[model samples]
Target: MGIDFYGVLQVPRNCTDLDIKKAYRDLALEFNPEKLQKENAKHVFALICEAYDVLSDPLRRAVFDQYGEEGLKRGVPGPDEFIKPYHYHGDAMRTYRDFFGTTSPYANLLDYLQNPAYECMTKHGKMFQQKQPPITHPLCLTLHEVFFGGIKKMKIHRLVYINDEKTKTEVKEKILTIPIKPGIRPGTELLFPEEGDQNPNQTPADVIFVTEDRPDETFSRKEDDLLMIYDVTLEEALMGTTVTVNTIDHRTIRVPITDVIYPGYEKIVENEGMPILDDYPRRGNLVINFSISFPKYLPKACKELFRKGFELAKIGGGFNQYETVNKLVLADKILRVDFNEQLPPT
Candidate 1:
């Protein structure tokens, strides 16, 4: 009934939201007024946009299904609020811009003509220009830069059409400034629409910048968290330790290790890692891994003295209480060592 919105989008009345979207994308690409350069294209795309907007929305689709196109356009009562009448904003490019920003970004496009007469100049038929493949470049950032948000300026060399007839071209340099938000994940891509070289008889391509984090020797990143390896002497590992560390963001923190720093021990500093994306003033934990460094050489007398001292203190008395250490270790070497590699009993 009325305008047949479903027919405009080339989708069935019982079509799914995904089907509506697919049909809309196809039609939008086919009749995108800017690319097609036709007056009729503008009206076609408007109907396509209106069809997509109504069908893709569940509430709107329900209203439109219950009531025909005219009824939906005349407005209806809703569960919570009164639904407004269906109307395309008449700016097809604006509607297409909304879709282009969200979807897979597969669309042929050229410059948006300031003059409306340009739409009429292509009188015979609307023609779509094929855009070239996008160029990808890595935007390398230091850990600190990723922590603190900043702007990065990049230079691009592109070929521009020199003449009105588009026969001659010249190489032009452009600087694109990209904003680096805090806690932006690695491998995130930034897209610059139609900002590439325009060769003769060919349209310009899009530019994409992929974010990459530079390696930090002191601190290693694990998602939003960070891993810091701190070294401690054998004495400090046995007794106690405390140390101050300079964070990547240039803040010094003192960590106390009152408990014995056992091997493979970790200290977690909360909210000290990379900043959380979209949530400012929040961060992940900074995990400090303890690396114990033992002295290279210890004489038998010193070793025995330390063992006797431990025995006197009644700390771990029966763990290694063998009478003769050398004979015991020598006895167990063949039996205990490399059990997997040892020969089976004959």
Candidate 2:
């Protein structure tokens, strides 16, 4: 017999629906069918599913709990027995006709041989058959067009070959927009059937919308959340200030800054932290990871300013400047900072 269903699921016999659901989720992560193929893994997953299928329903759980494994097997019917040939109506009709034929079956066979017809038959007979050639077309979509969700018009060329004749067909199809809900990661595929080809009998090929995330200059994906990084100049970092940053929503809003904001740093915050929740929450705070870009051809005025700063630092107190440079070059000394916008729960 299998292990106790409740014990295998790691839930008490009196566990609530929510508790059972959580247990199933935890087991699914470990025994995902697509990931594990070993015999043990498959057996474990099957047992887990069996436990859940029974426990999830109130009636099944009650019956199983009361009678154990024998209750499930009791009064179970066995496989059906094979019927005799004489029992079938179609077989009985065929037998009656064979017993009643007045002439011997060999009489017709002897007549074909007695005549010259048997010798006149050709060894090989041929028939002409026509085949329809399958065709494939080209489909393309921009990253932005699929993300926001709008109708897409596609032009496809088709080549039909019937017998020896060739015909070119061009068709324009409008694909209805599919809403790509936010928080779904890139590479998610949405398939729609009967929208690709016009074959009535054959199953129509699917129109697939593959999510290709653009090489974002400012955004990153973080498990159901979109992270965005922005650069803050030295002036803004030194004196804590608030600045308006643009987001996917196309609106600008003020976000407070602090000295803790530095380059290559991450700031994670809840959607509730943002002042702009439009029926639903959008992105939270901008992860202001600083980056510096210097022009190859510097102006004379700017070049001289650096030279003067270098000369003054060499003569005056400059130990801190050297230490800062050393820290930047050494990976061991690099620092990570997080400027969280939301407060921790009590």
Which number leads on TM-score? 1
Worst 10 residues of 1 by lDDT: 115-124
Q: How many backbone clashes does candidate 2 have?
A: 1
Q: What is the C-alpha lDDT profile of model 1 across 95-182, one tens digit per residue? A: 6778765322234333223322222223222333445779999999989989998999999998888899776879889999999999
User: Against the unseen true structure, what C-alpha lDDT does each candidate score?
Assistant: 0.76, 0.48
Please give the clash total of every predicted structure, in order: 0, 1
Q: Give the TM-score of candidate 2.
A: 0.34
